[model samples]
Target: MASVALAGCGKSNDAAKPVAAAGAVEKPTLKLGFIKLTDMAPLAIAKEKGFFQEEGLNVTLEPQANWKVLLDGVAGGTLDGAHMLAGQPIAAAAGIGAKAKLIAPLSLDLNGNAITVSNKVWTAIAAKLPKGPDGKVAHPISAAALKGMPLKFGMVFPFSPHNYELRYWLAAGGIQPGFYLPGDLAGTTGAQMQISVTPPPQMPSTLEAGTIDGYSVGEPWNQAAVKKKIGVPVITDAEIFPDNPEKVFGMTEDFAKKNPKTVQALLRALIKAQQWLDAEGGKNRAEAVKILAKSQYVGADPEVIAASMTGKFTFAPGDAREAPGFNIFFDKFAGYPYYSDAVWFLTQMRRWGQIPTDKTDQWYADTAKAVYKPDLYLAAAKSLVDQGVIPAAAVPETDGYKAPQGGFIDGVTYDGKQPNAYLAKFTIGLKAGQTVTPAGVK
Candidate 1:
């Protein structure tokens, strides 16, 4: 338990009036881990705004070097919980990387990523792009613009949304982003464009050095590229898949089972933080940028952080556009852990050959239910509603599955109930009953 005590609280406050009742918390002090990304805003906001203290929790928000380190810290108990990728808990639960029984009780936000191409690659693609009457490249530029170009792209992790979104975008354009075969984890078996792993912070420099032609990553890295005159953001993930689930607040199942009350309290505070972040048409976004720019937090320049956080993403140096829902936190029921979101990620994993065997649609549903604990999310939401912290309508009433959504750039409808059928609709990715080897898909 390596923990730094947050200011304004100490051991002396342990005797102060508790939120629920004295001795209600099984664990009072906690350390949560996060990577240096803007999507980790809820955790930062919660800690900074005393939401955690209001719930009788003493939280220390620790910034990990990267997503892998952050996930491992939560698994090993070094961190009580973490701001995790939507796929991390699913991948770990399926024994993909560092196997652990991690559960995501809350979804952090929706759609905070963009695909950025290096200046050279952008220049080439821009030449082919059709301009509108305003003399700017069309919004939601298709991946087809970069077709036939020999390029290498980078993502933050193997099982990250960045990889899947980028792959989906390329494949939609008839470009093979590649597959992950067993014993060959490089993920470039039959790729038209080679894909590699690069830390989020290093994406701009890596692109500048011509190591990777483009990259799909979350903010403020994408915004950082435009600020540095190294890359141009072609499209946001919201364009690829509207309101796509990005990150989740994940914890080891054991921790949740052991500290039920504490987990509830933590969720309560986080929900409030999310509401605040998305409140008033983003009135507090500027203040959030300042907090996230702190040395101990995201540690990025405030201007770069504000580029996307303030509802206007800088696609190019002077091409800023209005993107109100760019970084949705609490609106549209963003905090609720929808199982359909988990099933969608699993479909991508299977589509990319991460799951080396065929699975039933029921398997997808069961796995999603196991990792995405919407029951717990509802409980937390109910608690908040009881306390009048949030409106009842803010929490959706359902069986944990969202209605069939058809916002994918490829124009394919993902029902979540028919994963294999949805997967078979893709002409690029591995289909059902197909397995990938070092040689190729067999």
Candidate 2:
């Protein structure tokens, strides 16, 4: 992380003031929450590297016990803002987990998550894996080969994109990714399907102890397994979804309404942090890894974090290989938060039954409008372009990235404008306007 001095920020009326309401004042202090995962690097990089201070904002980075705690903190005003799962803001806005208007004006980074399988499970699947003409394991190692025995797959949480990403990869490979029934919120006891949730850092141990056959989680846990020689990374989300949105820097709706300018300024600092990370052909990655490995932060080894952060991936011990863009931070088209990214999460939420009722495509649009504020993000980008922090042409059309997003490896086109039509394309899960009134669902 870059060095930053945390000092009290005084409000400035001349800073373009976002396109929000007039005369919005800067926040006096910001209490930001994050779980210990590498995807939150932008936040850590902002604070440790002084990007926050450069924005004339005084910010405190707090670590929460888990995603739920971090979210509750933000919702209850215990936290001013936090790093969150890409789906958290959408889920909250759509009334899935906790009802609220959650806005992510900035996307932290992308492609940092990977699916890991235990050594035993890896061998079991690899044995049946069809070898390529070059004698290499073929892409998308499937679960159809391991169906003979029962196995518990793990996810970070049911509401987590980690869960959906894992589920998506499994289903794509001809395996059943279990969906929790509506209001079945307690735990996943009997998931006969291929994937489920385990906390990210614990993913390695859970697989090692045979509690689960495999898991999908963010670094450095996936790489940690390779460091420990306990498991092999099966596939990355980058492969499954292709630059799929992984994490976002989220703020509560109340915060946005009350402190819109503060939100934009905060976004400005985060965007700068991202550009720094991607600068100089990613030469700053080693410094970023040192910060993530601090005992108070991710607390993983620098080399382990590097395995993914620096674009090198290790599936198993002594099995390290070059996998560039494995963990993107501070660069690429990584900073802009897209509305279509919001729609994808909504589609997955509905697919897995977290979204109980059938919603129309218009409803999807309205819900997306309520969160994923690219308008605010554009304000920051404009500011960066003016400040010479970023080039203007590098910005993708912020109008929307969802237009027939057919580039998914599965060849399914997802146009956020027609979510219901997109939902119907899936062979699995309840389609639009469809409901599974499972057992006691009311």
Candidate 3:
């Protein structure tokens, strides 16, 4: 089965010839799932650019109703894998939401999400916000600006970057986003502003209908709001936590074990797609946005998708800014599943009371190592490097933990090796002996 790469992808037909290296895989056919968000670009690119086919894979990309369905599809074997929240596998491994032995072999993307407020909310707080030198509202508008107002925000999933970023932004500005008791799934206990779950595609409409005053989600949904004039994105996830891990290519641990070769093929194809996405300084993004705008994929207008995908992000109708790193697929080691990245998500889960009890730093590290399979990822990456498909420097060399990182909006540094100490620094979350209750943090 021979196919040419998509136009503007800057690849020859020979690009797909690396599949022979994978040998005969145990499973050649795959059914992968994704939500309708822009960060799912690598999956679309893999299928559209025939990277999957090139890697001896017959892959079917299905759009799921929501994150839960996508997660269940993978855990239940309906989907071999999925474009999942980074926290999904970590949560699953920790028995938080759905208890299953899931693992993230590859990270899908970084920093493609943003927090948007309804036009009503924006209008109410716009004048109070300080302006930049460019005579526009200053960027990274603090959540403190909306502190006194009664607001309800939406996130795609409870264990999602959207939820944690929204909470981090709010808590940084001294507003309690709340805690999750063992039975309290709502996570609104002691919250100044209520945050709840709403599917990604419904976020814009939900804001327009005034059902929720604001939301945190991946693009082009946030950009869709700007296009529809329904809401304005105040801050991006990159602004909240720079180069933060967003989504991952996740499957059940059993599936990975049973299909090691097949998993390598999948990772190889996906890594190629990611490289193409960030190639030539994002020269392929226009075609990527066009592919994502199709009915079966993201199903949004090309203009809307391009609003965030093509080197710039639209905060409002006229408020576009250069954000070259917004939807990074492979650049800056985006595809590498760092154990420290896993540990960061685990820290947030514990900080929000999703774990419901204290966990030692070593427990966090062990849990992260169990869930994030860097060995598997490195195996695939090494193959690609051996084939000269990617640069040797593309793969990061580390002992799993990243150095102390400090780009958070709150100015607090995070070290994956110090989860408990990091949790104690937060003024709004559960501390070492603290636990969540029906009343509040106890």
Candidate 4:
């Protein structure tokens, strides 16, 4: 396994001692993989801040080139687990891409992605966008601004939240981002705006090269564009879908079954790292930016990473705004792996024709339950609580489902229990009886 030499970050006060004693961690030495994204903070912080070491884990953190390589590493047992897109394990269970019985026992963080457009595209649409009273473009700029324009956009991976959030943002504005046909792996059939894949770090360069007019990705790539003067961020994923689940610590089900104590130890360390990240209203973020700027981790400039990670998001030059919720690590039950979060991803999979057929609501629920092991999350959280590491309230008292949420850009409500009903409300995307074909939606 390719490993990065981590720079030292002295242990935080909260992480100085082992919080939970998961007796006899079956595996003390382990290797994990992650893409170079800001959402991978939990893993990096855990390693640098000595949280992993406190929990008796000798973990090696490696940065993969892209999401596909990271996912394949985790699924193939080359790496033990990874900072994975929330949809990866769900797609695996649904047989959408690769087939594996992967499990997401804990969610990593929330709301760290944004959609950015090239400067040329932004200049074209800026003149038409209505301005608010402050003489700036009104917030939550809709995809309608690009209507009737033939454009191509990039996302990190087929099963990435970036893809679904971009599609959701576009479809909400009366544009069809396209669907996956039975034989069409590109998923551009019937597309009004073509969407394709690009690695996260390459987004800015890809946009600058004119290969894609825009892209949806996690920081600091979006921030990198604004810094490099290559593109302008139009909208954040939080604006598209509020407090949405993003990345999760994913591993094969077999690994979890065989090494239960090790899994709990890993989760405990990650939870501590998350709490440290969000501590004291983000006072620690400056230091975190420096740590993540190391070549082994995010490797972006601290200023660029801080643009989003330190409670502000920059849309364009001179348009920075306070965005405290831009990158939520531990607050508001961020670590708990909710089954509802998994169900929502499954619904999007079916919505975009990745599943290729209609599935009963029960199927969605069963699939979510199979892939999202909230029982394990609770067990890990409980251990921390018992040790007074975290407040009991920090652990959400949820029934594996969030209340029906309605902060969507389009004002459509999403109830995890009613995925089909929620999906049917979309003006675009496949309907209940419809399926994707090379010709068109059938």
Candidate 3: C-alpha lDDT = 0.89
After superposing candidate 4, which stretches have Cα over 4 Å from the reference?
1-23
Please provide, for model 3 over 92-150, each residue's C-alpha lDDT reduced to its tens digit, 9 standing for 90 to 100: 88888677899999999989999999988999999999999999999888998998998
Lowest summed lDDT window (length 10), candidate 3: 1-10
lDDT of predicted model 1: 0.88
RMSD of each: 4.8, 5.2, 3.4, 4.4
lDDT against the true structure, each candidate: 0.88, 0.74, 0.89, 0.90
TM-score versus the correct structure, for each prediction: 0.95, 0.89, 0.96, 0.96
Count: clashes, candidate 2: 9
Residue 156 in model 1: lDDT: 94
Ranking by TM-score: 3, 4, 1, 2
lDDT of 2 at 51: 67
Candidate 1 RMSD to the real structure? 4.8
Q: For residue 308, give model 4's deviation from the true position in Å.
A: 0.6
